[model samples]
Target: MSLLRLDGVEKTVRIPDAEPLTILRGIELDVAAGERVSVVGRSGSGKSTLLNILGLLDAPTGGSFAFDGVPVERLRGRARDRTRGASVGFVFQQFNLLSGRTALENVMTPLLYASGRAFWRRRALAAEMLDRVGLGHRLDSRPEVLSGGEQQRVAIARALVRGPRLILADEPTGALDVDTGATVIDLLEEVAAENGAALVVITHDPAVAARSASRYRLDAGRLRPDEPGVAESDEVAA
Candidate 1:
């Protein structure tokens, strides 16, 4: 069975006076365990909206979505929150690390909400994740002191510390230099594969998208297989 499936998923937002705005239209997708999927789109193509839906941060207004054989719409309240917290991870363009906290602490924040051993051993798990990301020596360094790439690595460590089954990255390399971004993407792919997690990368960089086994283009709120050589012609936003 697919790890996650979206069939004819649609998302529409209502405005006060204007007609409803549809961000996603008939989005059909399926991602299997340990798969790497990349989505490339221009600005306003609903990539972020799709990512939000896939990560369980938002609901679709139409069609259906299922994660691990369970219908997402059927989960309610804390059950939904707990399921999302335990099964999904997110890495954003800004890194989103706590400014005043050390790398270890930033990574440990998620585990605090986990029950049983994960809560008690949050420190060790966070440390191990940081080490896996090659930041073992910088565990005590704060986000302000870390470089952009290091900060992103810390964010990746935090996202993966819980061993989530799905990883959603939203323009994760947008803020870094080309070489640094390449390194970070490589690390992200490697770690996700190691953990046997499904990775969905929403990016503007063709180089990043090309690395994934499955590539798609999101245009005018529609998703389709990426066309050959189209990445060079498309004007994607950073």
Candidate 2:
């Protein structure tokens, strides 16, 4: 079954003293559970905007988003939060860890947002997730003491804590060096599959996109599927 779907979605932002800008215009896509989709595009092509809409961090100005067989735009407040928590996980370029909190605490934050679980139950689950992400030894360390890769691993643990059905990653490796970035990608793909979650990776690097099962590219505010034979290196930005 399709875990997530977006149809005819459009998003526009209005500046205080400037004209409006349309970040995503009538975009459509479907992601099957356990499928890995790579969204590739040039800078300013709305890939991140698409990720935001899918992650439920931002709403599209028009059209609809269906996640795990539920319509999303019409939902608000707790209802939307409930669905997003149950179905979506997000990883970003910067690991947005809480500076004052330990890595375990940061990962536990998302589970706290989850509706049904009690604190003690979620706490145990969070620790297991951090251990799976290979940061078991640093669970009590705060973000300031962790390396970039370690911090991102914490972010990944946070995303997984809710047991989400879909994983939306926006330039997750953008801030790390190439080797570290690849290792991060490896962990992401492994965990997503292990959990049976669909993966949507939005990035500007074609080489990164190549790691996925399928790829799409956005240009000039529109999205399209690339020819099957397209090489990841060939899609690299000039």
Candidate 3:
């Protein structure tokens, strides 16, 4: 079985005074272990919406979601939370690390929620994660003190500490320059490959998506395969 599966997913949202609008419609996809998939689309193309649903951050109005062979479309409360924490790690476009927390501390946050290990006892593990992400020397550096790429690396380290089977990254390289973004991408590819984990990156840049094994585009709430510069797959194949 694939590490993660989405079968006919759908999501609808209601604006304050407007009628309910469909953000996602019939999104069916799968991500296998060690596979790197990138989703690219314009701002309103439902890329973020689909990622949120896949990460279990938001519920789908229709269709089913299964993670690691566990049926989670209808799961609620502890069951859903448990599945999310145990199977998925999410990295947002913005480095969501606390400004006051050091790199090691940020990496430790997931472990605190996951391993149930004491805060002090998990320091070594956090440090190891930082090292793995190429931030060994910056272990004690706070987010504010670190560069944009460093902060993103810290966010990545935290995501990795959970040892999650799947990662949902939303514009992970959005905030950095080309050189820094390339380094960050390399880091993500390295660790995830070593761990045999699946990674899904949401982005708008074809250059970024082209680096992935598979790329999909969301356009007007429709999902289609992406082929490099061409937004549509047919253009590249023919």
Candidate 4:
């Protein structure tokens, strides 16, 4: 079964004294276990909205979304939170690390809400993940003291510490240099593959999008299979 399925999903938001604005129009996607998919879009093309829906942070206003064969609408309140917390991991552009926390502590934050062994061994798991990301020595370093690449590595380790089933990365390399960005993407893909987790990367960079096995372009609230040369042209234009 597909780990995630979205059929004709739509999202609309109401504005004061104005017509409802639609952000996503009929987004159709399916991600199998351990698959890698990329969505390329310019800023304000609803990429964030799509990522939110995929990550279970927001609901689609119409159509259907199922995660692991269960309808999203059916998972409500605590169930929804629990399911998301257990199954989905997010790596964002900003890294989003707590300023005061060390790399190990930042990674351990997710496991604090976990149950049993994960919660009990959060420290070890976090340290192990940091090591996996080649930051074993930096575990004691805070975000402010780390380089952009190191900070992003910490974010990635934190996101994957609980062994989530789906990894959602939104412009994860946006703040890094080209070489660093490439390295980060490699690490993300490697870790996701090791965990047998589906990876969904959302980015405007053609180089990043090219790394995925399946690629789609999000434009004006619609999604379509990426056409040959389209991404290159878009990058040139940008």
RMSD of each: 2.3, 3.4, 3.9, 2.7
Candidate 2: RMSD to truth: 3.4
Tens digits of lDDT, candidate 2, 1-238: 6777889988888889988887777888888899999998877777777887888878888888887777885679988877777788899789888999999899999877665554557878888989998888988999999998899899999998877888989899898899988998898898888889888899877788989988898765677786656533323211
Pairs with backbone N, CA or C atoms under 3 Å apart (clashes), candidate 1: none
Segments of candidate 4 deviating more than 4 angstroms: 231-238
Residue pairs with backbone overlap in model 2:
none
lDDT of candidate 3 at residue 141, scale 0 to 100: 90
Ranking by lDDT: 4, 1, 2, 3
The lDDT, on a scale of 0 to 1, for candidate 1 is 0.91
lDDT of 4 by residue, 34-151 (tens): 9999999888788999999999999999999999999999999999999999999999999999999899999999999999998999999999999999999998999999999999
Return the TM-score for each candidate structure: 0.95, 0.89, 0.91, 0.96
Instruction: Kindly report which residue stretches of model 2 are placed more than 4 angstroms away from their true locations once superposed.
Output: 16-18, 115-118, 227-238
lDDT of 4 at 13: 94
Q: Which ten residues in a row have the lowest lDDT in candidate 1?
A: 229-238
Give me the overall lDDT of model 3.
0.82
lDDT of 1 by residue, 71-179 (tens): 9988889988998889999999999889889999999999988999999999999999999999999999999999999999999999999999999999999999999
Segments in model 1 whose C-alpha atoms lie over 4 Å from true places? 230-238
What is the TM-score of candidate 1?
0.95
